[model samples]
Target: MKGGATVPIGLTPEQGQLQEAVGRFAARHAAVDQTRDSFEALAEGALPKWWNDLVSHGFHAVHLPDGVGGQGGSLLDAACVIESASAALLPGPLLPTVIAGAIVLSVDDMAAAKLLSELAAGATATVVLPESGDLSATATDGGWRVTGASGDVLGVRSAAVILAAARRDDGETLWFVLDPEVASASVEQRDGTDLTIDVGMLRLADHVVPEALVLNGIDDDAAWDITVALSACASAGTLQWAVDAVTEHLRTREQFGKPIGTFQALQHEAAMLLVNSELAAAAAWDAVRAVAEAPEQRQLAAAGAAIMAVAPAPELLLDALTMFGAIGFTWEHDVHLYWRRATSLAASMGPITGWSRRLGELSKTHVRDMTVKIGEAEADFRAGIAAVLDEALGLVNDKPSPLGDYDHLASGPQRTLIADAGLMAPHWPPPWGLGATPLQQLIIDDEFAKRPELVRPSLNIAEWVLPSIISSGSEVVQQQLIPPTQRGELLWCQLFSEPGAGSDLAALSTRAVKVDGGWRINGHKIWTSSAQYADYGALLARTDPDAPKHKGIGYFIIDMRADGVEIQPIKTADRDPHFNEVFLADVFVPDEMLLGGPTDGWSLAIATMAQERVAIGAYVNIDRAIALRRLAAQRGPDQDAVVRALGELDAYTNAIKALGVRETIRLLDGQSAGPASSIAKVATSIMLRRTFKATLELAGPLAMVERSEPAIVAPYLRLPAELIGGGTRQIQLNIIAQMIMGLPRK
Candidate 1:
């Protein structure tokens, strides 16, 4: 929500009707009970025939053109049916059918129409390739033998033709549509799901294929692109179906004394999953509609959407499963069906890592230029590096950050280009300087936030520390510190925590007794970010000896280069420290260095704390998490969609935890975007904890199924992260109570 597209797309009535129709179909047909057996059959080499029934009922024909023997409907219509079938766990050679239709659609003339027409009539059609283990017309004996065995075909036995990719002797890549039964090969029984469609090995030993079998008449690359696009659509459809099923389940299923769906945690999980489903849909939708966009752009967009897909669908399904507990995992339980579909669909499409690599490659070409990542702290300070990070409870940034990465900023009056547009400080009167309102200011912040690139420029952060100096220091100190700091004359680090002082802020024993014009400071701080680059720092000193603990502290802006100051980078679990450690041995801070009135430092510190919390919450990206869940949901049970669902849910919950911190940032800014952040933290934990609990519960006896490292890793990953982060659920509730509700703090 923080950086979502500002202008939303509204759907037409027809689209609404189409969606409803799809939903109705899912309601009537979704069945999870047979999911496991069917997938087991598929994995072992048998696929179901009921899948053929759905295909025959016009599932694949919904989107082909009228001349193609279809309803001549839109992609939206096709997707609706695909999604519905997925929700129901009906199996067909969907990959082949959709891929074939795509190849047919790419034809330049009546040939395409003819191909589509034949396929839409339920004639089995597929793409034959090395990717699918078959080749075009070329071989060792002069006639190309499409000699290869396709051990696993989603709907091969039912398919009259298959789409296969192969490398020619000259190394040219080609696709062919070959008939397996006719090929000089053996089709032997292999264990597959449900014992429906024949899942056999087709070993093409010198099997000849005709050049007419080539899908592409001219462009060799065309078929490949077609396959990618069509497969994306099918994957989208599968994910969407899982989303619908999970959404419905979340809305209806009850546990722990109420519909688990009603819980904020669950709803958020569902909401994120739904977002993923939308993304997958959007990817296919955009690719289909972007018949005009650049080929690479279209591919990138498709890849981006697909890459983020599977995790969300399956995650939501698994969440729903957990809510249903053991009943969901039972051979007779309804959830397994959706889970199975989700797993198979995901495995079929390829992994997210492949897509992410594509994304990273695309990013190299498309990343926008500007101050991103690092920024000058202030005017003339080129060495300065600054980025805004969300801090803990009661946290805040000392001033509006120096980073500006959002595109909209070029539209804003140049910072300092005009005195009217430039901001000086609380020092300048409203008449003499920028007089932006809180809302306007918030807009500036938001604009700075919503760039396609979310990071602020690293060149502008030289001044993040100057304002804190100006706010709480003496006149002499302000003159000595703020301006030069603004010029990047100095840098700063935060020396706040020690090993013992993590969340309990007031227990610090860092001493700095007043001695003449300066104070002697001694303490150790751990996990301070950016200390390696700082010339100065903000530190809290114990000033009061006998008064109440929190009230006796003083905030001091310190010179990092001061005598007795030391720094060390702290290593983290992931690796080297993003933050560092600082040890102070009787460091001297001049009297002018106190950040606020002595003992008033705690309140001054509150500003950055809240900002930090909200900033951290922004990572909660519910949308991102959901995208992943929907992806996992699209996988077929043949690939262990339920357990895969467990993996997906695990990923989604961690993502949700990041989002909750972002919401907290918003609340701290005084915008009541509902108590979603509070709700997010609470619900995320519950969803996470319960999702894992449900995983164990759903596994019933299978909780003991630690057959491999990967088998049970999903639940394990989801649970611990939920238990950690942002002061825990209990701590977050305390913030909500004390900060939002005016309740007494513990």
Candidate 2:
């Protein structure tokens, strides 16, 4: 976990610092062997040697309020420490202690002040809720007598305070704190799967407790949400460790004359590990943030995290172990410990099926709120942007054409209004755009999203091309093309992918010989979307044939209507003529049309492709998932498979959204965007393909019909293009493996 591209769990600077501090502390104080040594101590019902060191550093009370003798940080802050500590395999009751503290804090502030103070002062605790056992409470004069056999609870052996839940005879659940030293209460250490912490069972035989210790404000759901959130954080940390360990192993370990990571199969597998780790981290971050800042969103976030991160964790760890080959299976290696821990954590959550059902049921009524935070300084900017969108909405409403109509010529004025106001491409430079920062871009998106009817016209390929054009095009070219393109008058198509050069565009043989005042383009491009409707095309051709493949190309703007330019529609599986084969025979492009230097085409093309990937990756359509949810709801909950499928789809969809939010925050924080875009591209493609396939399966026999709900069948058939369009899934995986994981290329 020290080096290599570990997908980050903490997003902000402070959180990152906290993660680093905890990581450094763990490396120095709680080494791997130290954790291994703790196995015996833990089994003997004794605390790890590093337990006092950890407590002295204030790790246990990071999330408690300052008034409670704590540092007054959010749960996310605590999550950062937990993730880092778990990554180091720190052996103690850190997780359960944090969970117990958070649950108490969430219920009663006054009680939390005392309990949290004790925790902050180095006392340990554990929680035993109804999910783990059937405990019953009987009312007494001044206290309640509890009786039950509790399930195996982590940290119970060393815990001074026990947070237990019991069902009263009146069908009401009572939550109370019990002193483990009580005479009638018995604590027995149990051998468990994970060796990093002591696990024990608590049995109470009419053990009396003070009413003062009772937490009447908390219930089963609230406690469960808190547990899931904190557990998810620890899960993220362990998954991260596996990712880093496997990645480093793959990078250095060689087979068949190269690093094993160089093999495409291994690379793809490693890339998937990164993807899942990222999704897990995002889910964990979102869940903890919801617990800290958004009380209303707690249950949904927790359920989402449980399915997205916690449930798949054990399997994800197993996948990592498989990637490590026989070495991972050895007792000497650390992978098995993570697998056991993940398995125990998942079990502690009481089955993922229940979580999936809860998520599916929640999906029917609630959507996760993904709004970005707007700061005070940006209030004026947001207001101005909102006012512009309001005007655009009015203009859109006044239009004669009905909404959703197929009118290529409709809403021209509305598009111009938005584009002229710089709302269309606010991230672009001024005049054409506001040269907006990432925050401003997000704000603009927020304002526009508020008024969905005032749709800013899709720029088609121009959305991918215009950035390069603005960055490298001549001033005259920019003046002539950018304004009109922004207004949606100039639809553009990419002319890069040749029959033989689909993913490897540098291998393209399209030729463009320099003529006196221009370049004569003669080549062919296939799978060109919207070529027939495009007013212009961005062409990549070899300007110098003798030079290297990537070194001799030129990027030129071509007039799709120019002489010798031909567009032939290619009917795809969906039977739509959206794709076309464009052939150019001596199509003349003037000197100004050539973007950048002649040899700069490859770099420019790469930049465009990067932007393309980002755009495609960011555009996750959960509509299919919603449609499936509606269909599943109609079929009722009896369809467990449908419910599970819906839950899985919703989980990945939110994971993708979480990635988008993480990326936006990363950019806003002035950090490099990293490989998130590439990761998103791969994850989104897989999620979408699975979602459509699941829809078809859930639809039963009706999906086989020719006209079976065009909504479902159309996307199913059209998904292949998505896989191949921006960049093939394989290509994206290669990018992620190499760039993010630091794996060597073949």
Candidate 3:
């Protein structure tokens, strides 16, 4: 969590320091044994000394203001501490205490303030709402009589002070504080799955005669927001522990004389668990930060937290246990303990169905706001671009719409007008681009997004290839290629993948012999998308057979019209001829066409591949998730199997969308996409496969016959291409593990 020049998404440097500090504290005082001992002590009507130690050490009051006998820090700081403590299996009273402290601090009750100061120093508190109890209170002369029962309240018996919400005769909910020690309250301990915290039922019979103890004003929204945020942090922390534990078990547990982790199935499963943990972490941090910085965004953030934390934590823990084999099932192992804790927390979170629906409802409006952060100038830029687009829309209004399958406008007056204005390639350098800053680029995106019908010409690889070429290609190559590519006058396809070398492109046998002021290329490329329609291709060939696989390569721009260059369509499973195989028998490339150094194709290819992955990862289609959800809603969730499948698809699809937002935010911040893009690419592919499969399943008999819903059946058939294209899912996982996770290669 420690930040450098570039911090991870949703976290700042100070938050990182807080996370590190809490991690160290957890390592020392909140391990598995400590958690077990805390449970044992609770059974004996004793509280763990660690709670007081935390208060004494100032960790308890980190989120409170200095005037309240605490350190003034953001809620994000509090969430970090909670996350780290949860990772160590720390008990739950601290979580409830921190949340209650925040709520009490927001009101103007002197009695509550005194109790909060005590909580900041060492005391623990619990808040029980209507969801947790049947509690009710009535106002009397100078005091209130409270009588109700609260069930499934964690740490209720252990907390010295309790905050309970009850409805009056007027149907209004009021918040009151109860001093359990002084009040006539009885606590009955209940057998629960989570051994780390004492869950019990609390009954108050005509107790709490004190108007002074009632908070002046109660904001249930603020209370729930704080609780949800802290609970999400705990879930994130525990999920991380489970993921790490399972990962370590996989690395060490061997089967058939080899480590189980070597198996691709286990690798993918572990990688998925890691992905879930990441989503939880990102969501939790976002929620906490929203609480600290933007109160308006709190509901959206809490919804994200509710969906991510409650839905995934238990499942991830169960996955970890499954990965651990029979040992994980045994009582002696700690995996089951984590599973029990997760299940208990999930139950307390109520129905996943409601939270999932809430998330879906919030996504439409909230996600757009979270995608980018723009300043005043960028806002002005957007307005200016909007005016220009309005004018451009006028130009296309009366003209015959030539946007048919065979007659789409690629290069016409409409495209030419926009391209000339530098809107086509805003990120590219001047003459061909505006060299717009990240904010300006986002502004361009905002403007172009308004006109969905005005399609930008698919320059294919030229979008990425042209930029790489501009950076490294000779002046002649840049001047001749950049302008035309920008103007949509040129169409290009990449010719890097060969039949013998798809993922292993460096091992390609494509030979390029140096000739008189040119090179004779003799090679074959396969699975080239749109190769049949390309005017030219960005090609890779071996110039030195003696050099190593990655070192002996050269890149060139080969004209598709050259002699001996034959293109044959490769029919896919969908019966589409969009992909083609090209045989370069003896194609000649002039010396000026060579890109970068002779032996530098590998480096350039890596650069290009990186950009490709980013592009693929950033391809967020909002309609895709919505369509699947609509399909599920039509099918209904009456059957458990269908409901399970639909829920899984929805969760994964939403996660992909979240990952896209993170990636876009990173781009807008001018940060490197790095290996994380592979993570997103892999997640997207998996989500797509599952989503389409679930769609078909939901359709039942209707799926057998092709319908006009080309969006559904067409994508299902073409999904294999996506899984194989832009690196296979397995290859992406390898990159994620090796490059991002730093796991040793096979």
Candidate 4:
């Protein structure tokens, strides 16, 4: 993927232009050789000329208030600038200086205000985070005495002032802006993994600091949040570069007479790296927005960024290293350079355990009722839709139940009411649907969400099957069934896989014979969900036995109640009979029931499967994610192990949600689903397994005794089905390799 290949995660057009400009500057000034030279220069207490250029550009003042003599931009702007710099491997004091400026500008005191101006004017700054060992400050006659030591302080060598947190005698943490040149300190340069940046140890003796240098009311938590958010942004940019670099390698590098990217294994690895990169991007972007727009949720967002990006950055980079093969091991390749920076950034944020525990504690209480702003036009559209839905709900309630006490939503006046209001399938075209755009579709869901009591009718199989039918099914079939299906007048099932065919659907042995007025079908379909209750099925059978396997297949709409159709319930691990085996013995189907043509079933199946992937992959199971958090909160205090797992589950769940949001945006932009779409099912499968395992672990002895939480334990028994259903994880990977990555088929 290129720079603009996918939309820059959370940037506006203006910010994107800024990013491009910074990128061009970095390209000219921060080449690999230049980075090495700057590192050496910083070690000798000399500033590189490019550092002044950056300051002149106002990159260091992006997060500061204009009233304090700095640019009045949001934290998001600072994030973008640092991200661009990090991507080019620019060695600088930008991150720390920007963070320090934020703190100084936050206070209204004259001294703090004056410091903010100096910072914005390009005075270099370094930070010693709260996670560093206790640095104490005690009040003296007219000043304060500070004493402590911090290791691995980035930009310390070139920093004019150091921003640090120290505990006072009253047990309150105070933010102090100390001039390294003014204090008695020893700054020794140290060698580290990332060679492009300057880092060193700072030893501060018991020295007196003037009262003007100390800023009151700066909470330790607030400072930590700022540092984590900024570091995450920088790390995210580096990881993205790794992703693109590795991708470029796979595209051009060849092995054994073909491009190595043609291999399925490599494609799957690249796909996962892409997933991690997106997750990091979303996390960093969301964190900065939280700090700027929703201060109340800032802690939660910062912790989420750590859990999602900071902790995983190093590992993702290592994976990228693996993709680069032996050549990446050498220093010349720049892979090791990124790996070092990733690890260094992770270390700077402190231990992952502490972050996870904080995240767990926060997740236990946070409701996560997040809503992204989609502009005033979208807002008005949502309001109108909400009013319409409110009226529809009142009308439905006034009428008697057309379900006739059946208590099911598959059919009845309730379904009819929703269908009449064009709410049944808003994504579909008019009459049957409202032809809603992606954003409009979201707005519709938002309205429906407000009415939790009103059940949205669904035809489980028709969710994707009906869409496929409308796209390729004959006009008669669409006209006859689509409206009824939308109205909840008919239920549908799918019969595309046989026991012997499973992932290899084209090898199905089911046979369809053409007759004078219809086709005679004889086939056996297994693992069909809701088959016994289905009124119809989107069936796939062989029409031309002599042709190739895929070319001979045809798709049709078969009446489940037709003569010679046998449906036998198959008990699953949970002992529920939702799945069934259908055996068709010369089942007769009218020619009108055929979808597309006799030789188009394979293509139709592909389209339907893609839709299925999108539907399943984009569905965020917020309830499940929240339930785990609740369990962690309710568990015994001694259950630290389970709490850690709970935190991990929370992070993974949020990651899935973030990935879904990206996919939705991609679709809204009219970009077709790519490799990310293919791997979503795979990623979700892994997430489910981890979630269930954590739930069971949290349950402990309770799971072994009698019946446990049905929602938690039962899913374990059905986990294998999820991995195998829709398509096996391996099959999905193969699709990603061949279709999305352009790999040659085996």
**TM-score comparison, 2 vs 4, better candidate:** 2
Winner by TM-score: 2
Mind giving the per-residue lDDT tens digits that candidate 4 earns over 246-365?
A: 777887888998888878788888767766776777777767766654454777677778888888989898898988898988867888888888898888888888777777776776
> Order of candidates by lDDT, top first?
2, 4, 3, 1
Which ten-residue region of model 3 has the weakest summed lDDT?
1-10
What would the per-residue lDDT of candidate 3 be over residues 85-190, giving only the tens digit for each residue? 7777776577777878877777776887787788877888888865567887888998788888886777787888888887776777778888777648888888
Model 3 residue 154 CA deviation (Å) reads: 2.2
User: Candidate 2's residue-wise lDDT over 1-746, tens digit each?
Assistant: 22556556788899898899999998998888777866888875687776788877888889888877787888888889888988888777889999998888867655556787888888899999874777888999998988988988888988989889888889888888888888889998888788888888999999886777888688578788889988988888889998888888988898888889889898899889888888988888888777754554777788888988898999999999999999889999999998988888888898788988777777777778877776665899999998887877666423322213543234477777888888667888887789999988988877777776665565656889999888998888888998888776677889999998788888999999988999898988999988887888999999999999989999999999999999999998878786899999999999999999998999999999988998888668536675587677775544777877787788788888888888888899999866678888998998888898888887776666656543667567777877887998989888888877888887
In order, candidate lDDTs are 0.51, 0.83, 0.72, 0.75
- Root-mean-square deviation of each candidate, in angstroms? 14.3, 2.2, 4.2, 3.4
* TM-score computed on alpha carbons, candidate 2: 0.96
TM-score of each: 0.48, 0.96, 0.86, 0.90
Tens-digit per-residue lDDT, 285-367, candidate 1? 44444332465655554454444444344565576577566777786665655555555545544566555545444433442
lDDT of 3: 0.72
Please give the distance, in angstroms, between residue 624's alpha carbon in candidate 1 and its true position after superposition.
Answer: 15
